[model samples]
Target chain A: MTDSLQRKRVVITGLSVVSPLGNNIADLIQQVFGGVSGIKLLDAPFVDQLDCKIAAQAQFNPADHFSKHTYSMLDRASQMALYTSIEAIKNAGLILDDAVKPRMGIYLGTGMGGANSLEEGYVRLYRDGASRLKPFTVLMSMNNAAASAIALEHQITGPNQTFSTACSSSAVAIGEAARLIRHGYADVMLAGGTEALLTYGSIKAWEALRTLAEEDVDDLGASCKPFSANRTGLVLGEGAAMLLLESFEHAEARGATIYAEIVGYGTANDSNHITQPSVNGQASTMQAALADAGLSPNDIQYINAHGTGTQLNDITETNAVKKVFNGHAYKLSMSSTKSMHGHLMGAAGALETIITTLAVNTNMLPPTINLIRPDTECDLDYVPNVSKTLPNLEYAMSNSFAFGGTGATLILKKVK
Target chain B: MTDHSVSSDKVLDIDEISKVLAQMIASKMELDIDTIKADSNLKELGLDSLDTFDLIFNAEDYFKIKVPNDQININTLQDVTALVHRLIVAQKQ
Candidate 1:
């Protein structure tokens, strides 16, 4: 497709996050750039005997933040998403009229849906009986609950979907939402992911992988180190982000503040491992996104690396970036926002995109905190523990490659 | 994955089990540390029976040891902890 004809001009009009770092996107950016680490020692209940006992808890409870009745109806993951979606839609100054409300879509991504509910139902059967099941069990447990909750809360009448692809879930949702808007499938799309898997099952699953950082061995803030020599593993975090994506024309028609232009998005399967990453497939996805944006590696300045900090992930990611940029890897200022918020898993893509969007808008890159010792194979300008302002850069890219070999990248450009 | 692959792994450790159990219980009750006592009757806590199911599910995951249906009768917090301890120890064998 020709660059001109292929261009659908998707732009971020508003962004909001209910994240471990903070409750809103602007606050989250500040929290990250200010070097305020969200990782903390997991309290006793959450710290039973795991090797790693640190987490970036969202610090916001739906029951306290929203109506109790409303909270009861939605799963924790969906509740986290709804908080951000409401804020984002409002931040866009979108008091949607009937004309526009019907055209707004919601695409949400999640790692686990209503896990709490599923567990609760099982408990009921174990403790009580078959009759103890909640009437809304299936509705709450369905993966699309996040999207459905957003649509219902905001009265959005357009396409509603939930994408589930593990960690890449949200990134895929964001890209798909952009496609939907650009293709006139929807005018405004609330896109992102929400996750709160700090529960026993979720943490245990991660524990099985032996990936959770065990610095509760002590209060080590740098346990989330993404590409460093001492990098152990990711510190699990919880939360959600919602980005208001609309057609450039449509956004301008509504006089929305354009945060950043979604220039390109590319996704590819490694056809490799479910957990481990492949350098070739990762590089291919990055290359494809740059190509999709009609941008050469030279045109991009900052990258929000999908640096999970796990040994294999960081090494392979570092290799992918080097291969994709070749010699220009040194010129790029890459960072993992996960350093501040911990790994949000399904929500990581949406949260990282917000950081990348802000970078293009402010010309300042958020730093990768706790990156002290650089590993030999993983070498790059991972902006360490501080934000760097680069005035000349016009484009930023964010990458998210998840388990099951799903990898995705999105390129954003500064708006004139 | 029928979970046979789970127990066969050595990543399972003593310290890991406690951390997993703590996180599971807290997530179920949707409460902070103060409310989720190790010995507190899970029923007496603010979390109802629905919350207990989540606790059990998460416990199974954290330990990577299947909590059989017969063992799901966790009336007290001690029961939860003791059962988990037994299952986790058994996984080592």
Candidate 2:
């Protein structure tokens, strides 16, 4: 490629997450290392009415973190996004002034934007027989509410966008944010995904889908066992994770702590089935990401699998990995942090990408916590049950496969 | 049409209503209750459009009265107190 056509190097300058594991990156990383599963029996009134009684709920109180006016204006998802964004920006040490405000962008993802607000509105309108709804209901319940709120809070005037592609939403957000930076559209981007669909309506909707894990498990932590032979289904989760991505030159000029370099992003659609995952699509996307980074499959030492704990998804993802990595599949370490944190849906990829980046930076692989019995088909080394340390890890990939057959992969290399 | 019930003839207490309204506004604005004054302009309270909306909704819930959408233009705390008294009287009638 010509010098002018060369893509700019994008590096992760900061990371933050409001996960069930914890509210900040340090606590979340500690939980991941300790194999602490955040899944628990939900305490909502609708829990008795649903098939699944468990979820990985974020430990956040909007009243504690935001002003009443701010919390009223924000849905749960937006609140989490704003909290994570503030932490990430502060951690990145990027002061937003008049000069940089216009160039800073926000790319966020949410599977069900403001579902809590929508549910509350509906309850008030129907159940309570209230003729008038809250005036901010429409604003809070909109899919772009989180993104817009983040932009308004941070004064980011650049391309502000939100992606709602089911579980792959945040991964796509990160990928698109990197593209914006690589193409010289922006220097700093706040990118990630957040979801707060723990409301009655949200849980009931998932119950109707019948993909939630059965509620009879003795241990709630082991309910979501991705790639396990006895795995039942996915446990719903909610949280927000944000990453501050900046051009290499921008980060270095500011002397920011660079976590890892995001070298490649690849996304593809199965186009075959909406709910069913396709190995072909997954494999192709990983291959495409490897190609984008100009690295072979053997160069990657670890993969943060989408691993939704559903039988079909786990098996299909394993087959895809084997096809793409060939002989290197056995040597590579792969884990699904979702097994510990449940599945954050839209925010899954962002949180997992943070874990993947940390793995590359620290050379310590997070374990797939609940994998007591592995599926015969999924024979790859999953770094099961306990965290592992690798020496001189070079590159890692984070994968996100969604319900609509959308697949996204990002490649991050250890900073030299 | 009017009913000559004792409750209908009773005038709603303005001071109590003002206190309730100020508390709601203070809570919404995330300010101390003592800092909010009844004479302060609702706009000067640093409440944006959304915050104003929430304030009205909360007021309706507190008084068990329906606040009209057009009444959102209430400027001062006195104006809001008057509106609430009017709404409560109208609701009772």
Candidate 3:
């Protein structure tokens, strides 16, 4: 906190997504806005063993984008992360020469890094009784594999770190990356999260926790219905999202197109329960973010809630919103894009933050689809079932409450 | 490790090992088999340390011989082939 370390404004210049709904930003916008649910019955060999057979799977093939020699050392999660980062850099029109590369860094998050690779290795060792495994297994299965791959590819020498706080992993990553820019630690950072834990092992573990949504009897796609009276639980998903964050001054100097300004970020631990959401923690986190932004609750127009379609989470989050926003919660529009994209675990916050930024930038709020029954306890204008245009939409928020009792809130302001 | 030895009569010579090594390198580097000379430097042929390790691992599986860690200083396909030939010959004894 010296003169050179004075607070600076950080703005998102580029965004890319490898989501269940779509791969590119254009397709993502179309699918999310059109209320398309990406959840479907899984196509894996072990799907028959699990009670919940559906998930929101990204339509991606690593072989299509990488060479055998290159992708052979990457996990499914790293593949999505590297691919998304490339698209984000291209979208930002960033020229990462040697000088800029040193100042650039990456901060990524993942809940289950390299799950597919690890599970495959386990099968080889245990099930197949294989005495030896490939050398690439360890490299591919590490938690920081995605971030390391991006840095090695781009020759970024700055602080490359990875966060793994379960569902709030990417939220913490994005917020911390913004903090670094605000405090002059780095000029630019590629911040985001990726998760590809829809493997057979991962699904079985989630099923053991009894948190996965049952497949809808009539339509598998509607398995996840956040804030609805008939909501079951969160549908597992696999995806990646990356945002290029830089100082506002730097963006202005380069004439970059700004998506939205990251005005505030707040994170808090519940210290109450390991897997249950806390109302006080969620409320205080939102209030802390509002205070950090130097704005009251009434100034925010939209919120992309961490609505995971679970009964407890929905009611707890609704009560948290009411506690923090007070009467303003009724006036502002809120929705859970997870109803369409399913719960992406570690990648959820970054994806929802992008959705929130888009809502603020385009003046169009995406809806929480499949919310047909309307749970009375969760009383709020959820922008249910369809997208809407909100004139003069200025600021929006995205909240991520993780299973480990961590709550993270990020506020985005429309770039004027 | 389990005995991965091939039949005693099928012991490969240096030339045969060189041919198989060339094919592995060619397939891995996506180059024509004719383009990968036995004497060409592996680095010059666009094979880094990781690529070299991968090629060696595949060669070990194919020839059923363990290329010792000390033999990892191979500079060319000929060198790799010679090392594999030695390992296979040792395995026969």
Candidate 4:
């Protein structure tokens, strides 16, 4: 768009995560690749009263990572985002010297920011009848808090933005960040999503919607059964994942290790309904991404689905894939890592994108765990509770379809 | 919250109040208690204006004394302690 300069290519140079599955890249890869489940019994005080007592909670201690005063000032969401961003910078071996600092930016996504702090403040006000609250309550509770915290910590002074599209928040965030690099708005970007909404009030609200999975009678961790006939609903989860993205030329000039090239990104919304996903919306978005990547339906070897383990989502997404890929839909491998990690809400897309990137780079397919009895309507490979190696895997797509009918698709190509 | 007695009836001398103030400042700033000299400027010790407000709030809760916004013109740990002590004495009277 600017001066018809050759469209730049965006590539992922580094990745970091703090999720229910694992905290670092190695552990995450091991867990996902081994088809290990991260879903566990809820560890909150109010779990006993709630019907849905399972969640995928990230195991993190802020005191171990942040200075006492610094951690006190941040919400849980900001803490995860800041930690992952720093780790991603180090992973990329990036030097934030003067020349690069000004051109760098931060883009983040979150469904709910500072849920803990907001809930605590409300409890103090209404329950305890306290007149005063914490000084940083507003700063921590704002939706842009995580992005601002990341920007402040790294002194990234360009194009800081935050996107909130419910569950698809991070996917949209990563997609827009790549667009920024591709269009020459910024040379480098830290893009990702974070969510920490596992509070009593948040869960009770979600439970009221009747869209949460009931705990399995036998195995508590097997509650979230995506694409299964007996699936109840989604299991709420919390975590954060950040990726260091740089223009191809910028990364190459620095001799950075490229994980994958972000060839295409597509985002669309269904104007028909707010909560129910539209097959037309998902199909069109995937088609748009393929066209942008200059690839055909047959070219995509894998899809990281936005399968939320709900009755509506799994069936709708299956139909959407069939509509887009047709017969090739049967050929391509598809899986929902949410089956194991639960639904990370905002961070799902970022984490799944990273997983897709790894699949392209390493030629391995992550599996959809806990799918005991696949629904006939949702018929697909789904990788089926077992990870497998796929030789010559070159291109993979990650999908995130959120509430409010927002759908995002990202196409990643192997660096080779 | 600071671990001081809740009731205003609990009396403390200037030295005890100063010790308590120094401990609170050190904990809030994540500094070593021994390094928190009474003569050191709080700003120089990395406690910003917002941090001062937070410290006052904690003191109010711990010492059971109200700190008026205008009455706070503290620079050193000693000033904070003397102010809190005076507020406690006023509350008692």
Candidate 5:
């Protein structure tokens, strides 16, 4: 409320995660630290049909565990999405006590929105007829369905949108939401991503793209081998993650538990290719985010990488990290959460943000699971296969690179 | 059971309808002239789910028929032709 042009300060007050490794935040932190792997073999109909059967599907179905809403309008993906959003709002100390609900906003991201639901609808249509399709099919299948569902569920009348930039979707969503709160668009915001494309059609689409691990279909214990020489393809995953953001003053006034402050966010596109990643864009995006936070590269102690375990991504990201961090790259602790949780695509950024946030909150860094051998080019300290406790650090950065050469980076600092 | 074709005064012709349906999709999607076949699968012809929906939405506008969601999954170009033809005849009746 002080300046009309300058954005206000933003801080994270609430957090929730539903990943392949775990359902709740506590379980996720434990499994991630314990070197537990979530990637597994698939027996579903589509897996059997695909050349690749490996995926990091959620260990437990949210519907089986969480309460089912009466609307039933949401596809399963949006269901987990809204569930995490509500949980974050409640946990964030913003409990809609009349005054808080009116000032809040929600934003979500997804690489593929309701793909499973649309696929199912198509199957029914092909087998049956026009009358067989569900009444809510179109509404549930929109790319913004997750955000829309959360808005309806929480009754959020504030700004609502969905980010869909392939993999960097959630990172951009989180950054934009932070910007909104900081710019006084709202006092608080709920931001993150949800993606559940674990279906035959989606897997087939991946297979067609030739970005899937064809041979490892039966290996239930396999994890994404980021920066590994043998890394050939990325693993698909499903889940949702949400964070509750509020202005620092607003949070302090409300006596909320502040986890960390979102200091900077940067986004850039390579304009090079539709699917391939560019090292220059990655470097510039990281630099831009650090600059936005008004911190030097030396300020970042940990980096949660956009390590998809694909050969191209690993090598490309390694070059970018080395260039950006210089010699200090080797000194910085960096790891890929995809190693254990698999690639949640759009949700990866949101989930990785939470992972970095938790690291700051708990003062412990999770391990890079299944890295038996380091890739020759990627020599950065990956904190291989074992978690380590660390001293409190002021700044950490998370990187997200999506298809279409879109890149996003977020830098966060402890709130003191 | 009934020789409706002979007595069909308000019915749409299936063959003519198929030709027009093919042209509509091929024109809108900018089909690879050589690839577009009357019997070829619509998906194989590069008509993705979104494109298919777009075709249906346009058809709904032109025919003034509320196309149901379940019937939108027409697999082949022939399937689309048959659907349009049947729906037209039904609407006329």
Candidate 6:
């Protein structure tokens, strides 16, 4: 309605990720291009306690990155977030001087915050009969811990917030951050998600939900097969991904290397079931994002799908895509990076968005690895098993649908 | 509140209370028990406000006596030990 609102543009300037594939963004993109699978059979003592023993665990050691005192205060999720934030900020080359520090903020998302710490604390208290739990247990387990920690670490005094929207958490976070910039609330934001819920408690809970993929074969890497006929369900994963978003003018003025412009963000709730996703909800969200971007469905070239490898999710998402894009759905390329990275839970959308941005920036579409035996009902070109290169890509969309029937979509465009 | 009364014969002495308090603070701070002095200020021992609150909680659980808000202004290990001894003595009576 206002002139200021109409003129402001949000763009992603820097991206970093701490994933199962790798820590740095370049290595992660490289691994994805190589059609690598990060999922592995977890060989921990706790694996024996769960129905599903495979997860895309990050190959990172927090001790190597943090001091004993600092590490002791952080949860695994917070550590991953902080690590990625540092990398993202450095990559953006934006020095948070006193003038900029107050305006810059953080928006992080996590489904289960500090689950490992909570599990460890409960085990110590109930099983070990310890009289006193750790002092920082509450701080470490809070859902906003990562956001608070990042804000404190960077001294970001503006709009520090966290979203806990299950699988759609990070997508909502990135969407909200973009809105903030578009509304002229802030100039820069560290937006993304982190998750480290690989503990016994978390795994057992997911097992109870019956959503974990059954690992029948020895090679657990093939466990997650999104949009495939043989796909069982999603394998759990732990990681973090962060994007440094700034106003387009701010980035251009600072001579920042723009990755891609985040043009549209849309979010909607199904209001139907707690776990089951609604096709209408998914379609409407995608439609809303396209409408927000002021672009027709035909203009989009690629889509990073939220294919969770679940029987219900893949089919529902495929139908939703068909509904939203209509004829163009068959033409444009779409794939689920979750096949390679597994489900990062709240961090899934952030990583997928990063991958989608890379696809738009480099014109190289990452494949949905292990998509053998495509589902009959789910008929879409999934860029199956191998990466593709298409130069001068125009528009790409990243979709994230969550457990509480929340759906979010982000439309990104190549900054040519 | 649940009954936290200790028998007069089972009441803990100041020395025992001091030792437990020191161990609790040391554990919370991740410091060696031998390094924490009874007269040294908790702030000097790297116990921030949150650490002090947790130490008070652990002290209450260990002694099975409720620590009043007034006693939370403890600056040294002696202060905590003295407060715990007073609370225990009062509970016994």
C-alpha positional error of residue A297 in candidate 4 after TM-score superposition, expressed in Å: 1.9
Return the top candidate by lDDT.
Answer: 4
Interface RMSD, all candidates in order, equals 5.4, 1.7, 1.5, 1.0, 13.9, 3.8
lDDT of 1 by residue, A110-154 (tens): 888777777677777876664445556887888888888888888
Could you tell me which residue pairs clash in candidate 2? none
Worst 10 residues of 5 chain A by lDDT: A63-72
Q: Give the winner by DockQ: 4 or 5.
A: 4
Looking at model 4, what is the TM-score of chain A? 0.98
> Which residues of candidate 5, in runs, are more than 4 Å off?
A1-5, A60-71, A127-132, A214-219, B1-93
Cα deviation in Å at residue A166, candidate 2? 0.3
Candidate 4: tens digits of C-alpha lDDT, residues A1-416: 44436779999999999999899999999999999888889999888998888999999999989998888989999999999999999989999988898889998989998898999999989999988887788988999999998988988898999999999999999999999999888999999999999999999999998999988979888888999999999999999999999999999999999999999999999776878888999898898889878899999999999999999999989999999999999999999999889988889999999899888888999999898887999889999989999998999999999888888899999987
Over A1-416, each residue of candidate 2 has an lDDT whose tens digit, in order, gives 21437789999999999998999888988999789999999978777877788999998999898877778789999999999999999999998998788888999988999999999999999999988888888999999999999888888899999998999999999999998999888889999999999988888888888788875457887888888898888999999999999999889998999999999899999886879989899998898889888999999999999998888999999999999999999999999899889899999999999999889988999999888887999999999999999988989999999988888999999998
TM-score winner, 3 or 4: 4
Better-scoring candidate (DockQ), 1 or 3: 3
- At residue A396, candidate 3 shows an lDDT of 94
Model 3 misplacement above 4 A = A1-5, B1-9
For residue A340, model 3's alpha carbon misses the true position, in angstroms, by: 1.0
lDDT of 3 at A324: 91
Clashes of 2: 0
**Best model per TM-score:** 4
- Docking quality (DockQ) of candidate 6: 0.19
As a whole number from 0 to 100, the lDDT of residue A264 in candidate 1 is 89
RMSD of 3: 2.3
Please report how far candidate 2 places residue A235 from its true position, in Å: 0.8
How does each model score on lDDT?
0.82, 0.89, 0.90, 0.90, 0.81, 0.89
| CA displacement after TM-score superposition, residue A235 of candidate 1 (Å) | 1.1
DockQ of each: 0.04, 0.67, 0.46, 0.70, 0.02, 0.19
Task: Give per-residue lDDT, candidate 1, residue A289.
Answer: 90
Query: Tens digits of per-residue lDDT for model 6 on A1-416?
Result: 22554758899998999998899987998899889999998857877777788999898888888765567689999999999999999999998899888778898889998998999999999999976676689999999999998888888899999999999999999999999889888899999999999888888889999988888486778889999999999999999999999999889998999999999999999887999998999999999999889999999999999999999999999999999889988999999889889899989999999999899999999998888798899899999999999886989999999999888999999998
Per-residue lDDT for A108-208 in model 3, tens only?
98998999999999998999997667778898999999999999888899889999989999998999999888888888899999999998888989999
Q: Tell me which of candidates 5 and 6 scores higher on DockQ.
A: 6
